[model samples]
Target: MAARRADLRSALPGLRRTLRYLRPHLRPERWLLAGGFGCLLAEVAFRLIEPWPLKYVIDAVIEPGAADRSGIVALLLLCAVALVAAAGLRALSAYLMTVCFALAGTRAMTAVRADVFAHVQRLSLRFHGSTKTGDLLTRLVGDVGRLQEVAVTAALPLLGNVVALLGMTAVMVVLDWRLALIVVAAFPVFVLASSRSSRKITSAARLQRRREGELAGTAGETLGAITVVQAYSLERILQRVFGADNQRALRDGVKASRLAAGLERKTDLLVGVATAAVLLVGGTRVLDGALTPGELVVFVSYLKGAFKPMRDLAKYTGRLAKAAASGERIVDLLETVPDITDAPHARPAPRFRGELRFEQVDLDYGTGERALRDVSLRIPAGCRVGLVGPSGSGKSTLAALVLRLYDPTGGAVTIDGHDLRDLTLASVRGQVAVVLQESVLFATSVRENIRYGRPDATDAEVEAAARVAHADEFVRRLEYGYDTVLGERGTGLSGGQRQRVAVARAVLRDARIVVLDEAATGLDRESSAAVRDAIRALTRGRTTLVISHVPEEVADCDVVVRLEAGRVVEYRPRALPRRGETVDARRR
Candidate 1:
């Protein structure tokens, strides 16, 4: 009993947190909620009124001395018609109640899902780097969807049943407080049975939800790498791992079901005992003339109506618990604080002159390894600079700071004499264009993918960017030309083709500062040349930062900065290449 109490105490906080997340969303749904609850109350009233018609019909049949033959027939007809009317009205009220709640519930939950998605998108790269894509997706889609489904299917009806139970019980007490006491006497046992089983079911359901998320994560990871899996012939290995998690989820689901079933049977037993007791006592009273037969019949009907909710609670407990678990998961995600956000007084950045500087900056990712230490350098506006270093030498880290992907632990990074932190993140990132080694492309049309760089770009602008990236020819050759939709991650295109598309996206961005991080590393000689031509066009008058180890890729730079162990070891200047000179000249 103490353990049950403790569990309940622990769960209350999580339940309250879930409600907090729901509150704001519920505001927009207030009118719909009001109508739904009003209908629910009307339905309960109709239920209470429903049993009385049967009571009147029985009384009319048993009491002939009170009326003439024609009068009795007229009363009977009225009673019969009243019963039908009450039943029909009650059903209509229920239908309206269900529709209203379903609409409100679905809309509120959808808004919540959208909010979570937008929050996750705005979170820092560090958060995304540490989180699993599949788990986040489950929270966004699966968990939120579960909340909506259960709200409509299980929660609303259960709420109506509860209200009806209360109304019927009150009516029973007024009719015969004695029989109502008998029914009420069985309540404590029902409470005990349900409370214990409900907690257990909730625990099991929470575990089940987590395991399901893990199952999704595992499947997503494997499917994303199925080509590699087949190449390495490790299909059996991954299958075994996935099967183990699947079995665990299955076990959890079964456990919750078993607990709910136990509660239901307990409810059934209690209902039987209460009903038997009521019939015994009420029958004796009827014989003693303390109550009329019709009244006893009404008491019994109300008793059944009241116990029905207990049975329903037993039946729907597991589903409610799962919804609760899903709600808590969503709240947990919503409560997560993003590491980066706009400063309270931050303003939008102006169009930059593209001068960038790192002033004694330091970065620590909490791994006890300083990613950058006292790193300081300056790049003049519109100058082409190169960064050459061993892997993990903080070359990429420095580039990331320019875009405010991470803030320095100490010191500051500035763009055009303004600290990056002083500017709105959107404005800061908007003015910088980046093309990485393994650039990511979406499963979208060629024109749309390029337009992603600038969402409002026109068709002519997209085509122009494509031509500059040397991607226009191949894109035109696709089945639908520029309108062709590629596969996931742009899988239908080869590496070089994908890279070129990414370059086109960067080209369409038209930012004053460009970062090329090994953008041409893995391409074939011909493809590399084409991409280089595109890069040259894209960075001609912009401030360009090139990170590469290739001699020719950085040979035409005005400066080359080298780093070792998170510190700048060398900063050297090279004569600027003449107009129309190829970078290949330096390699030769």
Candidate 2:
């Protein structure tokens, strides 16, 4: 018993947190909830009145000669009216309760889902790289959805049932104290039974929820990488994995179901025994002239009404357990603090000249291997520099530092003499733009994809940027022109076309600092030429840092920094002519 109490105490915080999600939404719907509760009270009052009319009818029948035949007829009519009125009020109250709670629950869950999504987006790349997308999706969508069910479907009805049970119990006691005592005695037994089974039900439910998460993860991972799966003929292996997870979920679900069914049956048996005992004791009193038959009939009706909530509560035990598990998972997620957040005193950065400097910067990926060690470099305002290196040579890491994707472990990166850490993350990131090798595009219209970089860009501006990137011709030839919707990740477009769109986006951003991380590395010859033309347009007046393995791609840059094994091995400065000089003269 002590252990059970301790467990319940531990569970309360999770329940409280889950309920907190509803508080903000409930304020606006307070009146609706109050009205629903008022209706519930009226329904209970009607139910109590209902049994009295039946009692009058029974009394009228028992003593026909005590009153006129018309009196009996009137009593019977009253009974029928009371029954109909109670039924109508109950239906009305139930409808109000369902609608009010459903609305509030839906709004609360929607807000929570949006917050979780925003939080996920704000989390660092390290968190995302380590966490599975499938697991996060399950938490964001599935777990949140289950919480809604608990708040709306199970919780509302449970509340109403509890009120009804208490009301019915009071009415039963008033009708006949002796019979009420017999009914009340069974309450503790029910409580004990429920308590004993609760821990087991909760454990099973938690296991089932975990299995469900695994199943969702397996499905998402498999489908997300379907192309790779098929190319490698991993269909059978993935199928086997999915099947195993599905079977475990199924087994756990069945176990939870069985426990719930057993709990409900036990409740039924206990209620049945109590009802029989009440009938036996009350019938004897009625026969002995100590109680009227009409009173005994009322007692039986009240008894059933009072125990209905107990039975319903028993049935809902499994659902509540599952909801509790989901709630715990949600709380765990919401409680996680983001690894990277702006300091309290951080200020927005002003427009920069884009002089970037890394002073004794060090980066350790927490894997015992240092990615960058005491590396320092400087790029003057509006200067174009090429970062050349073999694979795993910290070239991309340097670019990431410029974007503030990950802060250096041991040193500071400054932009125009302002430390990156002291500047607001948003302000710093807004001034820098990147065009990666694999450009990511949403499943949207071409015009919208271009406008994503600058949401308020006009149609003319978008078109001009696309033309500069040489993507306007193909876009115009599409079925819907700029409004043509692409598939996920721009699936319908070739790699070159995608790269051009990305370039158009970067052109639209018009940031001061631009990083090209192997942007033209994977393009075919014709595509490469088009993209190179676009790059030339993009870097016309920007501070550009080009990371590449190809020497020719960096040949025109004024300076080149080459790194090997996390150390700068070479720094070469070319005597190139100033901007606007002829290409031949600059080369000379």
Candidate 3:
């Protein structure tokens, strides 16, 4: 009982939060909702009237009445017509209610899904790194979908049933107070059963949702890395892991279903008991001089009508619990404060001259380990600097700092003497472009891919940028030239070709600062030469930071900064090495 009370307390907050997602969307659809509710009232009225026809037939037409025998056939026909009219009106009202509620629910959930998706995108890399993509997807898609079900299906129907229940109860009381009391007496038992079973059903549903998320995450991770799985021959291992989670979800679902079934059966038993009691008592009253046969029939009909809502309420309890769980998860996600956000006074950065500086910077990745410590470096505008370091020597961390993907735990990074933290993130990022080791391209036309760098760029400008990056030659040779569509991650293109497209994109952006991180690391001899030429063109007049493990790759830099243990061990200008020179360097 205590646990059940605790669950109830928690559910109030969850329901309130979910209603926040619903309330704003209701404004636009207020009239529609009102109309739907009006239809519900009409449907309830029809139901109340529907039982009246039988009552009239029993009392006026079928009773021993010698005076009304002349119009008996007409009276019977009128009752049948009233029955059919009530049925037709009920069907029409039901259709209107369903359509209106569905529209409202769909639009509201869609808005929430969009907001969640956009918020997830804006969340920092740190959060994404710690979170699973599959779980996020499930929350964005499946969980939000459940909220819609709650609104359109469970919530709306439960509301209509409550109204109907109340109407029927009032009518029953008016017809015969004694019979109404007998029916109402069973309600407390129903409520008690529902309250107890609801907590169990809710607990089971929460477990089921959690297990489903885990199962989705496992499947997504396994399938996304299928190549690695195949190479490692871990298919059987992955299958077992997925199967175990699936089994757990199945168990939770079955438990919830079992609880719901038990509650329903209990409700049925109570309703049957109530019905039998009403029959025995009302039958005696009918034989007495107090109650008419028509009045007793009306009381029975109202009794059943009232109990119908109770049955529906019992059935919808499990769905409401599931939606509440999903709502809580969504609320938790939305409430997560981002680690990085712009200050109130942060301003848009003016056009950058790209004098990048790191002053006594430190980066702790929250694991009690520093990725960079007191790393300070300066690169003059238009100067090409090469950052030479082994893996985990804080080279990429420095670039990320400049990009504001992360803020330093200590000290600051500045561009054009303005601290990056004082600038709007969009303004800061707009002036910087990066070409990672593995060039990322969307599944789109070559022209569209290049235009992604500058959405408003003209076709001619795109072609010109492609030419500058030396991508024009190959792009034109494709089956459809610049309009040719590429597969996922630019699968149709070679490593060097993809890199050139990335360069083309950067060239179109025309950002003053460029960071090339191991951009030529995995290319063959011929591909390396082409990529190197493209990099030269890209860095012609831009302040460039080239990160490479190979000493030869950085031989032409105006200055080379070698980092060891997150500290700059060496910084000096170096002349370009000869083509055949074998320059050796130690890893960090």
Q: Which digits, one per residue and each the tens of the lDDT, describe model 3 over residues 1-588?
A: 222233244355677887886688668888888888998898888888888887887888547644766577677789999999998998899889989888877877888899899889889989998988888899999999998988788878877877888898888888789888998888767766677788888888888888888888898899878889999999999999999999999999999889888888888999999999999999998888467888888888888888877777667767878888899888788887877788899999999988888888889988899988887776678878899888888888888998999999998899989999999999999889889999999999999999998899999999999999899999999999999999988989999999999999999999999999999999999999988998898888788999999988888887888887787888776653333322222222
Candidate-wise lDDT, in order: 0.85, 0.83, 0.85
lDDT of 2 at 135: 80
How high is the lDDT of residue 496 in model 1? Answer: 84
RMSD of each: 3.9, 3.9, 4.1
Could you tell me which residue pairs clash in candidate 3? Answer: none
Best by lDDT: 1
Clashing pairs in 2: none
302 in model 3: Cα distance from truth in Å? 2.1
Expressed as tens digits, the lDDT of each residue in 158-194 for candidate 1 is: 7787788778878888888988889877776776667
TM-score of model 3 vs. true structure: 0.93
lDDT of 3 at 5: 39
TM-scores, all models, native as reference: 0.94, 0.93, 0.93
TM-score of 2: 0.93
